[model samples]
Target: MTETTPYDADRARFTRQALARLVLCDHAVDVADGAAGLVATENDPDSGPGGRVSQAFQLIELAERALASAVIYEREQGSSWAEIAQYLGIGPAQAEERFAANLEGWNTAFDVPYRLDETGRKRIPQLPTAAYDPAWACEKLDRWAYVQRIGIDAVSSGLVMAVPEEELPSVTP
Candidate 1:
């Protein structure tokens, strides 16, 4: 088991797709915030070139996390490997192989929420920071999306999150 941080007794309350969306949105916001900071840095006289360059590099990492979140969200939504591969312009096998670990780690988090650190004492959370706490993610993402001029919720990428199981009315199949 890989090292992790922040293991809470309460696991995620959201479904895989909802959690994935929060992760995606969080990363997306980070990338946007980082880029905006870089732009602001350019106007600051005290800012050095290294500062802007370093922030730009951080944006790359944020963007990569955003991409991974997207892939995880897609899989949870019943998107086939072939469909993702088509968009990625790679063969299905290639796409699956590339992202298998990310999906596995996500799925496993529900079963085993955390693992011991190298010292075998401290517990680490397996889920990403955004997915670890549902309420925080929903509030932050909802407010962010609504204020971002995206308007009301539409889908996973849009504002809002999955309704809690208890909140849903019973459906007869």
Candidate 2:
């Protein structure tokens, strides 16, 4: 994306927006990598028909999906249409019109988490893949975070749960 994507604060670490941002970044890297490969093969006549251009083209669609996810996340986080519109450079009504269906679908997904696949045996998640499988997203984003800033220890993401006092072992020395 040409514009900066929003991510949640540490207190809301690994929120949908954060995961969507991670996906957006991943798409960007993919685009860069495909471009590099295209460059590398430019002079080589023997390296023919690798479909690198196709791969990069596909990234645009993925980036759009990622952007929609970001919008949905922003709405979910209680950002008003005007606030989201400012960054998008459109009027609030326009912004809301563009993203309202996405927001609706996002909300509906939670109400109906999954649907039956064509086979009727397999289940297909209604939620976006990253948000649907949050543990995987956390692991991936955590590593990305660690590489970007050492010692953050994003591996320990999410609020810590307290153990029951009665379950504690005896502390006699």
The most accurate candidate by lDDT is 1
TM-scores, each model vs. reference: 0.71, 0.58
lDDT of 2 by residue, 112-167 (tens): 66777898766676766556655665577667656655444322333243765578
Candidate 1 regions exceeding 4 Å error are 1-12, 41-43, 146-173
Q: How much lDDT does each candidate structure score? A: 0.77, 0.62
What is the per-residue lDDT of model 1 for residues 1-173, given as tens digits with 9 covering 90 to 100?
Answer: 55433334333346778878888888898888787666442245565768667887898988887887899999989999999999989999999999998889889987887788999887777788788976777789888777868543323332243786679999999
Which residue pairs collide, candidate 1?
Answer: 4-124, 5-124, 5-125
Worst 10 residues of 1 by lDDT: 152-161
Q: Give candidate 2 regions above 4 Å deviation.
A: 1-52, 144-173
Count of clashing pairs, candidate 2: 0
